[model samples]
Target chain A: MSKQGSASALMAEQSPGPLVAFENVSKIYGKGDAEVRALNGVNLQINAGEFVAVMGPSGSGKSTAMNILGCLDKPTSGRYLFKGVDVGGLASDQLAMLRRHFLGFVFQGFNLLARTTALENLELPLIYQRIEKARRRAMALEALETVGLADRADHTPAELSGGQQQRVAIARAIVTKPSLLLADEPTGNLDSARSHEIMQLLTRLNRERGLTVVLVTHEDDIAAYAGRRLDFRDGRIVRETRNTGKPSHAQ
Target chain B: MLSNTLLMALREIQRNVLRSGLTVLGIIIGVAAVIVIVTLGAGTTRQVGSEISKMGSNMITLVPGGDMRMGGASGAAPPFLAADVEALRRELVGVSAIAPYAQRMDQVIVGNENRRVNIVGTVAEISVVRNWKVTDGRLFTLSEERSGKAVCIIGATIRKEMMAGMEPLGATVRVGKLSCEVIGVLEPKGQAMFGGDQDATVVLPIRTYQRRIVGNDRIAQILISGADSADLSDLKLQITQVMRERRNIAAGERSNFSVIDMTEVAGVMQTTIGVMTTFLSAIAGVSLLVGGIGIMNIMLVSVTERTREIGIRLAIGATEREVMLQFLVEAAMLSAGGGLLGITLGLIGAASIAPAINVPFVFQTSTVVQAFLFSAAVGVIFGFMPARRAARLNPIEALRHE
Candidate 1:
């Protein structure tokens, strides 16, 4: 499936709806005196083709909110909707299917399987999708080429630099052509130059393919790359702002 | 998908070849032990069967006794007489031949060589009853047996050792104090089932052995060969009945003699070997249990080590089943590979060792197949808990693990 074509078609059919929505979502860890509240009545939305950044300190629930958005965790209360379908109502397996069909994930650790080559790492999601070997190889190479690491396909993560490993991780995330790419601190392990390179790659994917991007970072520059930013503090969204400094094609 | 998972599992095992090999060492030894023991046990059973058959399948040995297997006849039981053998010969039907048997341990000297040998005294019918054939000369004549002639039949071992380069048929060997002429050389019968060599003996006339060796006419045992078409049990019943009446034994009392059918002895031996094989295999199976535990232990450690990898797979849309299957396949391959190696080693060991122990090398296909299936099952059973733990891991926490 062409992600751009499906995204535009979905936008034409569901023009006014947000692609992902959280309604009064709250998450609490324990019940009694030792209880901890991670998110409190957090409401948020991201439209199609939008690049949104979640910015918060260590205990500010930014990671918790990203986990809910990625369908890795369920909200304790209220509802999380992806394409107007209630994610909390679906079974664990069904949620997995939803993630497989529509979402991709990038971690701060790059999380490419150790000792596996870059091309094989990129083929991970497609392998889960049960794609045939030849087609999956072709798609994985195309994704690697998109991230400008086509020549490094045969190298393992141990052989590649941090920037190259991140690029491989990005290629893996995009190999299935998922509409939503949820990247949690994608440049957290890279230097300033590599971090900018990774950010630019995300921006280009969002611009050219209409792939909605959700980034979690505390860095001001990293957040500046997004068209919209939500700052979390004390288990709630303390502020929301739209950036005018960086002209994003999605915006 | 299954093939892909299997390939991935194989690759994972290959990544740590030494660790994998170390982890499966217990299994290798376990399977190999079972294979070797079972194969050797089968070989011994077959050897016993053939040895017993060589002694004549239709032959029944009568011994005056307590328990025959515990030892030979107890001295308390009255010995059989010449009348007992004659009565069995005349009264029993379906009997091809009968012989009065008596033996003594004595040294035989031929020139300078002196070796201890069994001095068996029996009638001319012993050759027919025991299925023994003379390879060199003729058996003692009936007149020689009746008239107490100083003639004997030497066995192959005596022929080989005492008369190696000379004509054995007419050699005179000293049987204790008597210088007996060897009229014939019996065919080499190799070893007996229990112990001792069957071919290390000298046979003489019963009258001659009685007059010279013991100065008595008491027969220690009797040998009877049943007609091939007759049921041995029925023939044994008839012989026992005749002996009981002739000995004037009461109806409900224990008889002084035991009639042992050679075929029954062979059957009992086979059953005993079968039981022993099962017992030894069960003991070997304990090591397999330990090996299974070794697999489980390593698999748990692998799950812990690969937590982050599992998280990555889960986040990338791999289901819990897929993760579990990967580990399960890995463990199965490890144990099954061990089983194959064990079979090969076991066969090699058995093949080389069977002849050393004087038994045939029996390759049991069912045993091999069962061993393989059992080893694979060991892997699956032991691998389950670790695979489940890996599958149930929280992706969020797992990704955060070091």
Candidate 2:
């Protein structure tokens, strides 16, 4: 019976499709002489439960890619399939629905609503889902507990430290139980020690909750924490690597 | 969705308190001004109507015309004769009373005090027809009127002015070097509907005024009072017929003397004031347009300021309709709040000023409610453009905005 359960768990893990897939996506900014290619012919696939980091210098299209993956923006061309659904042809409302149902975004600045408490920020996605108040509060508290921010749920973003605020932002991102998480320069504003702590938290969420994280960053040290890396330059992916070593703190 | 939008709007307004307050002020003043002006105008009309009503709804005035000139002003129309008054009283079925009156403005001297006062000459029945009450003493007798005796009735204003500390009853006052004994002191009537000082006058018997002051034996004008039970339109027709026949006027020709009905005059005045109020309110409505423009301007700024926030919301699954509704609700709330406050302030302002200017204060519930609704409509009309712009914002571009 134990052998059968192990085999079924392995199958369950393998059965879940790629959480996010980009098929020859290209985003062009303007026409002819004023033309700028924000994302030029990008193709990538991220499996469920994988923690992937996208690293690129300025003007390298990493931000543009992150925006498209997060369903914040539509690609100028090519298909973006989020959880096997073609997202390229989706209307603005449909895109929003996709984002609401399957995607969660975290920004580097924490991007917490300045005056709102951590609990309210966490409930924002549920508000979009039109969830009832009592249920939303319970879900928000559960998410806060997941992020170890339950005690500080009532505190506003302004009252929180940089690490605590980012945790609240993470709680907000995951409160909806989205299939994919997109973090753009999540620890760019934090010091090295704080950045390491945030990376550790992301690793824990990836391992325990089995959340698929696609983090965009410029830092090499930040990318080292991820199990897979895609590096970009001049709006195109230049390299891809699998990190076979244990994460820096894991050693 | 609406509640979420409302929450976002409230948060935005709270974040920028001063700008929101300023935006609402424009609508507030506009609505308040409209309410105050409309209320005050209505109050003034009511006050005028009531004053005219006090002078008797069935009263009519007949002015003099034609030859037999008195006091020798070369071929000028003479004063109305007693025959005209007699014909009106006898022939007209709806006629209740006739009082032939002659008026002269002259300096009246009562011992040490002297002042210019309007002196009216008419029979004692004039007081009843004109709705004038005698506060003290008695009206002149018919014998006194026939004999051209010097008995007179003085108004409260004239009595106050000429006799000051002394009681005016039985006091003798000289008008144009003729002494007349005051038989009664008329009550204070205040300003007439036509802006005349009704209280600042002296009344004497018609014969006495003609014989002693003007040195003529003719009436200046005839005051006609209709029966209380008679319809005013029917009475007017009857009076017109009697006067036309009395003067032998041909068909299609206008009557030489004008017969003015107090009720008709009052109606005309009310219609005129009503039109004026409408015109003034239309002009005041221009302020609402200005207020609408102000709202649009502020909303435009708000949209620009919150473009990033809008992007964030859009990215998080807020639809264009949600964003549009958010800003639209904010604008509507601003104008509606302003309108509510404006109506309250306007009523207070109108009520405070109406009595001081001798105008009746009227609080029209419909007008107040209409003003409030108008302000809400203004918000909607003006807020649409900015809200549309906000809703149409590209999430990616907006998020990228610094």
Candidate 3:
């Protein structure tokens, strides 16, 4: 039984293909002569618990692809499968259900509601989930603890440091205990130290709880923290790099 | 769930306290205007009803030449004579009593104190015909009415203005050009049924008025109180006929005299007030439109300002329904808050101002409730378009907004 388990583990590491798969995706904006094809015939696969970084220049359609991956937008033509369930066939509300249960998002701006306390910000996703107040508070506090922000629960975004605000945003993202975290330039607004701190937080969330993270960034060092990097040019992935990992700097 | 949303809405309003206040100012004024105007109109209507009743039920007034309209009559023909009053009393059926009165706005002097008063020359039956009570002393005797004695009954207002600290009975007051003995003082009727001081009167015998002051038999009008079971309209007709015959109007000619029924007067008053209330409320309701526009403008701005926040919510699993609810809840809180504030302001305004104007202060729960609900509906109706716009935005584009 132990030998069979070891064999299957090695097979899983060799081919981690079942979690998410995108086949021949395309996204077009406008029509006819004015049409802009954002993504054309893009193929990609991201397994569960993979920390992937997407890097591209302005107007390169990396954002479009991320939008599709997060179920925030639909492709003009594609088959997107999460856990082998087809995204193209899912309705809006079903996509919402998928997002509610499986996905969390962080923004470069820290997008913590400006006047709200960190705890309130963290409780937001749970509020949508309709969890009762006591349990929601408990879970929000726990998420804050995970992001090293339990002491700053009562502090508003405006009152916190940029790194703390992003920490609160991360806490908000994880409060629902989602399997996948989508971050768009999560440290884009911060200094080097704050950016490093934010990266470390995301790294810990990914490694410790096995949360899948897909981040978009322009900075090479920031992209280097991911286990895998997909570089884009024009609307196509031009190169891919698998890193040995950044545990030393992340810690 | 609703409470949570409401709390969130309130937090947003509190966060932008100044902006929220400015946004709802129009709503507050609009709502307060509605409540105050409706309340004052209702009080005025009530006052008119009671005033008509206080003229004594089943009452009719005989005005000369049918020319008296909303205001006092300035005669083109001739005034009603003492004989016309007598003839109505003698010839008309279902008449309980009759009194003829003439009015002169003049300065009455008691010692060195002088004030303008409505000097009325009427018979002793004036009290019965008008439901007037002489509080301090007796009304002029019938012998005084016949003999044209220089005696007068002061109304409560004249007493208060002229003789506030003194007993007025047997005190001689210089009324117009004659000195009349104060035989009585009338009970205080705060305001007349129409809209003036009912208490600002000094009554003397009609004969004394003609013999001493005006030196003519031209009385202003005659008041007739109908018996309890009498049809006042029929009695009015009877009085009109007798007055026409006595005044010698030809059979085909329109009667030179007008017999005015109190009931008809009351009905006209009611209709006029009803129309006035509706007109005023309609004007006030225009402010609500302005208020709704204000709400919509603010909400549109809010949606635009929070576009990225909305995108964040949408991207993190918030349904369009949830987005719409947040904005809608914000709007409702704004208008409902304004409504509550407006109601308090209106009640305070009505309470303090009505008494000073000598009208009733009537609190109507229905109007208050209706105004409040209407304001909230205004929020919903106007807030919906902006909220829908916010909800329908493409999340990718919204997130991309700077």
Fnat for each predicted structure, in order: 0.58, 0.60, 0.62
What is the C-alpha lDDT profile of model 3 across A46-65, one tens digit per residue? 88889999999978889998
Off by over 4 Å in 1: A1-16, A244-251, B66-71, B177-181, B212-214
Q: Highest DockQ among the candidates is held by which one?
A: 1
Please give each candidate's TM-score: 0.92, 0.86, 0.89
- Give one digit per residue, the lDDT tens place, for model 3 in B1-402: 678889989998998999998998888888888888889889988888888888888888877765645435456767877777777767888878898878888888988888887888888887888888988888887788899998999888888877878888989999878998998989898866546787888888999988888788888778889999999878877886787777788888877667788878888888898899889989988988999999999999999999988887787777788789889989988999988988899888888888877789999999999999998998899999998998888888888888
Between candidates 1 and 3, name the one with more favorable DockQ: 1
Report the number of the highest-lDDT candidate.
1
Ten contiguous residues with the weakest lDDT in model 3 chain A: A2-11
After superposition, the stretches of candidate 2 with alpha carbons farther than 4 Å from their true spots are A1-15, A28-43, A115-120, A134-161, A233-238, B65-75, B106-115, B135-140, B157-187, B194-197, B228-254
lDDT of 3 at A53: 96
TM-score of chain B of each: 0.94, 0.89, 0.91
TM-score of chain B of 1: 0.94
Pairs that collide, model 2: none
Error of 2 at B172 (Å): 5.8
- Native-to-model Cα distance after best TM-score fit, residue B5 in candidate 2, in Å: 3.3
Q: Write the per-residue lDDT of candidate 1 for residues B1-402, one digit (tens) a residue.
A: 898998899999999999999999989999999999999999999998888778776998888864655226668888888888888888989988999989889989999999999999998888888789999899889899989999999999998878889998777889999998889999999877667998999999999999988789989888899988989999989978998898789989988878888888888889999999999999999999999999999999999999999988888877788889999999999999999989999999999999888899999999999999999999999999999999999988998899
Best by the TM-score measure: 1
Error of 3 at B391 (Å): 0.5
Q: RMSD of model 2, in Å?
A: 5.9
Rank the models by lDDT, top first: 1, 3, 2
